[model samples]
Target: MPGKSLSERIADFGRRLAVEAHAAWLAARDPRTPWPARLLALAVAAYALSPIDLVPDFIPVLGWIDDLILVPAGLILVRRLIPRALWSEFHAVAAAASKHPSSRAGMAMVLLAWAAILYIVYWSVRVAPVH
Candidate 1:
């Protein structure tokens, strides 16, 4: 990691963030997680996973703002809300889980959803009769 290039380091950071976000999602649903922390964790995970953005990524300057600011802020807030020991446990669990690896099922699902949305929009705009 010390020898890694800037781009590689950034990528590593991104991967870690993804793993932690997933862990937060898991913690959010756990029966043992405190209610306040659970709510915060849920919000963090939802915002991170959401395809739709508070500021759409297409817009200049502001588009990437939420990604740059909101998700990390939410994660930080969640960190404070959860007990330290519990947070450490979740972090280790998340790190180990990240190592196990998985397929692109979530990506496939997202693609399918986007395709459906696009089809509906196209059908309504092109096929439906207008005034």
Candidate 2:
């Protein structure tokens, strides 16, 4: 890190994020993971692994929020909830990186979620008292 250039540091961060997401996915499926942690981990994995972005990249500021803030926060929370030893084991596995990492179903799930959000917004505007 001390010797790394800005681009190198950014690349390292990206790689670390990918590794953490991979680790979360691996941990979610493990029976050893506690249910609460597993549930959060699964959600994080689905979003991170999915090719489609939940908030589309064309949306400006909101687009990067999930990737930069949400996923990492979710991973941090999950890391705290999971036993350290188990997480360390999965982290190593994720870093070694034997993964296919396709998520077509995750794409469908993201679309549905966006539709539901849009519907809620529409309904709220329709029902609101017009001042």
Candidate 3:
């Protein structure tokens, strides 16, 4: 790190951030996760994974604030909600998984899951019991 250029350090930080976000996603999906923790982790994962930033990078200092602050804060909250042992396991799994090549099948499954969830929500609302 001492001899690394600024860009190299930034790239390293980005990689670590991706690993953390992946870990949160894993924790969110795990059945053993407490309901509150799962909900929070899901929120964090969604926010982190989103391509649109709250403040666009063109905005200079303000844009990086959300990336450097909000995501890490959310990750911290999620880490606290999960038990230490479980979080460590999740982090390890996520780190190992990150080394693997990206999977289109995994992407399709996630999209399918979200579509199913949306359909269920719509169906329930369309048939709500209003006595």
Candidate 4:
């Protein structure tokens, strides 16, 4: 097999991070999970999935701070909180999810949903009764 390009590897890593965050989200809700671990996992997953960032991505070097610093740090903290046995299971699930090809159709659907929402807002503003 040919060696993967740098971009491919980076994309794979990003997928893995998303997968692991999702897995942790699931694990956090389990009854057996410790409260502290659950809290950390939930926070980490929420931060990772949130569209709004602590530092907006358009802000040059500062924009990347949350992504480069906070996320990895949160993931590491969550890992420490999880018990060894459960961590292994979460790792396995994350690894499996990361290996599958991403769905372009799903991406399109999300984009369409956002467009529809924006259009609705625009139309509402245009047609609203004058105050």
Q: What is each predicted model's overall lDDT from 0 to 1?
A: 0.75, 0.89, 0.81, 0.74
Model 3 poorest ten-residue lDDT run: 98-107
Candidate 3 on 1-131: residue-level lDDT in tens?
35999899899988888888888888989999998999888877776776655556689899899789988999999999999999999899989983623434335545666778889999999999987
For every candidate structure, what is the RMSD over all alpha carbons to the true structure, in angstroms?
5.4, 2.8, 8.4, 7.4
Candidate that scores best on TM-score: 2
Model 4 agreement with the true structure over 1-131: per-residue lDDT tens digits: 79999999988877767777776776677777899998888777766766556556899999887777778788888888888899888778766763433334334544666678889999999999999
- Better-scoring candidate (lDDT), 2 or 4: 2
What is the Cα-based TM-score of model 2? 0.83
- Kindly report which residue pairs in candidate 2 clash with one another: none
C-alpha lDDT of residue 92 in model 2: 95
In angstroms, give how far residue 41 of model 3 lies from its true place.
Answer: 0.7
- Angstrom error of the Cα, residue 11, model 1: value is 1.2
Using Cα atoms with residue i matched to residue i, what is each candidate's TM-score against the true structure?
0.67, 0.83, 0.70, 0.65
* Ten-residue stretch with the least lDDT total in model 4: 98-107
* lDDT score for candidate 2 against the true structure: 0.89
Runs of candidate 2 with Cα error greater than 4 angstroms are 98-100, 118-131
TM-score of 1: 0.67
Query: lDDT: which is higher, 2 or 3?
Result: 2
